[model samples]
Target: MASRTTSWAYRPSLDGLRMLAMYLIILFHTQVPWIQGSFIAVNLFFVLSGYLVTNVVLTEMERTGRLDLGRFYARRVRRLLPAALVAIVGISLVFLLVAPVVRRLGLVGDAQGSLLYVANWRFIAQANDYFAPNVDKSPFLHFWTLSIEEQFYVVFPLLILLLARSSRRGVMVAGLAVVTVASIGAQVYWATADPIHAYYGTDARLYQLSAGALMAVALRTWPVRLPRVGARAVAVGGMALFAVLCFSAVAMSQSNRGFLGTAACLMIVAGLMLDEDQPLAKALSLRPVVYLGQISYSTYLWHWPAILVMGMFLDVGPVTMAALAAVIATGLAAASAELLEQPVRSAKRLNRFRWRVSAVGVACSVLAAVLVVPTVLEREQPPAVASGTGGAAVGKLAAAHSDPLPKDVDWDRVDRDRGTEQTCQVDDLDRCVLHEGSGAHVLLVGDSHARMMTAMFEQLAKKHDFTLSTNIVSGCPWQENLRNTQSSPKRQERCDEARTGWYDTVLPRLDPDLVVVATLPRDHGKWHQRLENRDGSDLGLERSLLRATRDTLDKIEKVADRTLMVQSVATPRSFVPNDCLTSAKDPDDCVVPLTTTNRPSDAYYLAVAADVDAAYTVDLNPAFCPAGPLCSPVVDGMVVWRDNQHLTASFVAHQRAKVWRLIQQTGVLDALDGL
Candidate 1:
């Protein structure tokens, strides 16, 4: 049998396809209303990469009867590493110089992962949901896709080389089919079970790449014999369908993986199958479109960081921000391509020094790691303060409204203790006793807001002779059948499961004497103001919230003798307390107005309490806000909030007396006294 050899040609239609995909991604990041499904562009890129790279490997193997692994790796390193290293080093330096310590803390790890081409796995391991609200976007986030491509570049060639001596085409086709099936299966399973992780996982995304590879193999080994008219029709129809899908109301969510992946693969196949002289192909081959496609990689690399940097200082509307981001990204991409990418790619002498390039990349990664040392050390050390003051110093500082806030008070420590560390609260059915005592058993159930009360509750538990058990999940309310509209689908799934498990399993087993429920009402306000829904429907927010809260309280009443519902605290509008304090010359500058409607109203809780006989509403606003026109970030010389709404552990400790009094006034403690 004779092996077949074919020459590769430049396809302008493919370049046009690349341009379209890149622009869609940019628009998605801009967060325009109609382009919600723009994330599918990534799948399109994967398919294109699979087809082009597979075709290259197959052609080379057929012509030479073997693969040159060294040359292949060297080519990949030269093409990708230089621009990537520049971006990583430049972004890291900017962050260290300008960003707040809190924000800079995680960049080192992100940089290291990106440098090693494993950033996707790093993000997945951190449970960093791409759709999370109000969270700062990582500059290295776009590197995840590049990481996947690089992994494919390394592995796919080796596979082809291994099969070169045997019935290569037959075995390769069979292997690709198995891979495609397994990858798709994994995607479907993970999309249902853990969507956020599934979105970033290599296993879930391999099918799209495999689809392209299969198309390449089929074209080479058993070419499609469609009539010219049939081929043109397929190309036109596929392009039309792809455009419709990209612009349609379909959500780019985890559950829609099959549709998204399949659509992207089909688009790539159509682009490949079409003849160059076809009308659609001629349009795609235009000079401007090809130019845009040429710089697509650089555009993708620079756009995210440009947007993030602009967001850090600019207080502009979304449209304005998006426009500014686009301009900056374009300029950077053009400059990078002309000055850096082109010059490096054309330097033939450097191609022989592959080891040197690898070494340089490694050295840059080491520098990034070194840069994060101070932040790591700072996190490990506890805040310096007077011994046995028992939070009195913070109280005094707040009362004085000290200009230079106490340097000894560790704001980060306050944040860490407030359930950000998973150990502080029970997320699943597993019991987490926050504080053990000989007194009555009191269970706290809510989200991070409830976790914020841990220090105060623990103090109260010790003073009032009560034990504390916490069942809390961050960003999750205690309400049943209600989803966090701002969270990713996977997070919502976990929240629902955890809530169901607590209500069904944990509560019944423990049967505590008192149950306390509290969550940040900011989420509830988002539900109402944005009129958001779990499924993105336009439902009646107020009614839905009331029903969910009522159902949750009803469940709690069944398992506990008494229930206490805490009123949501006053959260400043668009203000981060720590950021305010960091730059304040006078502590008074840190104070924000606390208008009656500044925070989310307790209408849902009030409505739920009116119906549930066992549930009693506890208003702590008087103690925290005290009928004030303005609220201070520092209360009694201690930081009142770690961020906007969450209370600092030190401040909460200072208010232990007020919290204990409120718990006693509920008459549940008096009743527990008899027990």
Candidate 2:
């Protein structure tokens, strides 16, 4: 039972494979729009790493007669830790200082968890919810991959050592094969069950690494010595195949995962096993490609954040055209490698004291991350709560220090009270707040849609010495529950809880002077939105809106005072208001000009307004949606909306003239305004 090292097995072909894998990585991240399947490069690396590391460890144990556990771990620490620490610290700082509310985005989960490599698990928990995917602000989201690799290295070496005790070669080979097979199976099962978590899961990815380890063992025992002609062909064929695999892997849609990934990795390994003396080998081993391979770690670390910052913050064009960005990023990464990575990697230890100090620095980072995330969460407003099941609450609540609502909500206490109900149900928005002041008592109420009008309400309140209040809650239908109680699961439960809570907790508490309710009613979901109409066209949108309007009027009658001021449904715009405004020739002409000859129609809101006006006698729609088919997103040099759908803060603030006058006409805020 001799180790592979004891029995003549060292191959530069593997380095050739590493070269190919890294090249794929470069192309994948480059996302050179033409290179569709570049992502498959990661799979290739996984396979190659699995095979090579396994081979090395098994071979070492068989030949040396004993495993140096401490040295093995120390080597791993030396190879991975310093670079990782530098990257994490550097990225975390960027997020903390440069990015707005970056720490609030959940950069590090509970502090200690991120430092200990359990950030993966924390991500798993968060990612399960639809809203949780982008929750974290950490620039180190990519570190989960490294964490998985490091975790595998830690355990796999120990497993190989144990298996090597009995006929080292036989057990080592068998154990690796068994693990590889099991890992592949797990991948297939979990990928289907929970693709998001499974994709990031270490267990599902182990087989790819094992493939490389197995290759290491096989080459050690077999010794691939090809004739010049044969060697050249193998090498060339492997290289070509590797390139094909890379292209193929990246080109495929993210949906097709299992078979393609396995096949791609296999191709990379075959290429790596080719002859060292072959032309392909000589080319790959050249100083440039080899140097890139050496510094690839830094390249991978910095490339993504560079792209993210450019795309998200700077509003860079499509990722396909991010070449200049990539270039700048690459130069910086290379410089970091030379200045930071190489120094730490090649340095001789000064003393045990220095090592201890470095360890403490690492610990401090985790502590800081933990403390920062919660603080950020506390500062933002929470989402409104739609009515739901009896015992369960729908939205996440912000604790004492963190505001669930934004600061602008505070201009009117009435809005804050309405926001409280909304926040109780949905955790997605900021709760409205009211500042300490002397003013008219104006109340705003409805669903999440009404929350957008806060700026307008606050402006009107300030100008007229009126206090503003809101009755908006998030997620819950301000109109009515469109889903049938018997059919819908989440909606049914939510509606019931909201109904009960509104009647019990909210209704009796706030008897404000005036109420303004806004709602966008619609029936949306799998079957409802897809059903056909009388003329064989889709009438789902129209029907859904109509139903929603009816439900809204019903709810408004229950809570609103004698004179309810209802805003007319404004024409929906599809792009951000400012982007459109900025693109226009003159900022004053901030309107989305209409192409269709017909007047803009919103069936549900119009219907609800018609019914409510007839019953309670108030018309606020003309102030907002007055006149022609064209809807001016910005009126009289003022922007009305921040985004495509909802009213912007600026728009809300400027609505003072129209909104206050409407309230005066209706006599809704007379009591609070001292009229």
Candidate 3:
């Protein structure tokens, strides 16, 4: 037989943890000095949810010898639906009032995804790039995590039912072990091959949930007994580790896929076992922490969007604004939890009827938001155009509004590329082969960053009468030594072999006048160079990479006259293009001004540039962020960084003239003239 809590276990420590978790997330979103990893609170949450929900189900099964699937589901609906509906409705009203058509479309897409409890899948499919701060601007983005948990609930109850049917203890343990292994294997596979998909896929994330379920089963069968002297110390240590991961960005990037996630699960399990009956637990049960836990859901829902709104509309300092907004949200959420959530949740009468009504209303509101909001915004004004040489009317309008969709764009004509290629076009990922006047005067090599340089070089290529050949791959770097080791065993070897062959074969055959090489900066600490080939033969990756750069430069120098290296440009945040769309009513949801800074540092390219023989270096930083240290995003008449990073295509194209001038000045054309 299993035991159930009295429905009031006074587990204040859990509340304390919840408070800590939400605060970590809140602080991280504020872009506070170094709390870069606060996003991991979502992982902590996943673990807690698995343990608590599994414990609840197992307890009920023990009491009745069967699971109440309907009641369990009903309870979930009652707990989750009301506040979600409120948030959806609130955001909808705000969207209708303030958002432009493009913004409204994005918000509607986000809301529709949330209504179906499939926001995670939508994001993964969109490759939404959640780490970009612009994600917070989506009022419904937090729902992705909610979707993951809800989807887990759909499968987890059945697993519990099957487990409970076991008569033999050995059989039960064996079944759990098998499930644990299989789920973890799936997670590992997904994490490496498709990190974004791994992030949101219910199947890939089941392992984290199962870890909690397994812990619950273990606690049920074999209760942990910590030594009296070491018990408190152990609990504190686990909590501290949890805090470090939640607060430190460096730790976050390292732990994002599998290893850190597993460690978070472990810490959660240890904290749960610290015993709710302990004095520390009683202390955690204090009014403030418990109250926060009670409203944790509302807090999570409110915080991200509130930050977005404030950041977008206000000139207040971000730290102060975030702090003020979190406080206001906490107050509002507490009130909602007390007056709305708890009342509807606790009343049995409202439970059945309200759940159905709430669910239906949420669905309708989301639909209306998707279809109605965009239609209204579009009708209010024509789509805005990007400024270019398109004459006064276009220029005046573009200067009036920073959006680049163009009044005549016909989005239907533009290919969203959903079919075979998925998000980005496959053709875009392939190497570009451009015909020139004659001999190869310049070679562009590296990843996408290197490819972007072609925008400038295209003009110079025509001017200098030299041939331009680019042997570039989307994400693949020109480094001959580093293999694609960030995937599964079989896929890793395959990618490694293909990329390695490209360097050894495709590259050597196209020996150009000057080789321009670039790549995204490698974090030196975790940097691993592939030293062995597929057959286990030593390849000496470092030495080979050095040779590749030197040899290419030497060959280009001999073939023509000059070798020029175009320094890598900075990578910006992804949402900078759409940040200004948030309106006045939800001012808190908009992006703050301070986040706009020059693109990331380009110092890493100096090392590679130094190794090049007879090559002059030109960095694109000044051309892009021409204001020097004060350079910020500019497009049309507004900032182009929707998420305080990533240059919008409109901004890139707008700077075409400046980009062309930079190329002509680099003497790359002169090298081509020599050829």
RMSD values, in order shown? 16.8, 19.2, 17.8
> Which rank order by lDDT, best down to worst?
1, 3, 2
Q: Write the per-residue lDDT of candidate 1 for residues 470-534, one digit (tens) a residue.
A: 87777777776556757777866667666754576667777788888888774343465633444
Candidate 1 — which residues are off by over 4 angstroms? 1-7, 251-255, 258-260, 315-319, 354-675
Model 2, 272-326: lDDT tens per residue? 4554444665676777667666666666666666654543334233354356455
Please, what is the TM-score per model? 0.58, 0.54, 0.56
**Candidate 1: deviation at residue 468, Å?**
21
Question: Per-residue lDDT tens digits of candidate 3, residues 386-409?
Answer: 111221122233333222323333
Error of 3 at 632 (Å): 16
Question: Higher lDDT: candidate 2 or 3?
Answer: 3
lDDT of model 3 at residue 206? 69
The per-residue C-alpha lDDT of model 3 at residue 562 equals 48
Q: lDDT for model 2, on a 0 to 1 scale?
A: 0.50
Please give the clash total of every predicted structure, in order.
8, 65, 27
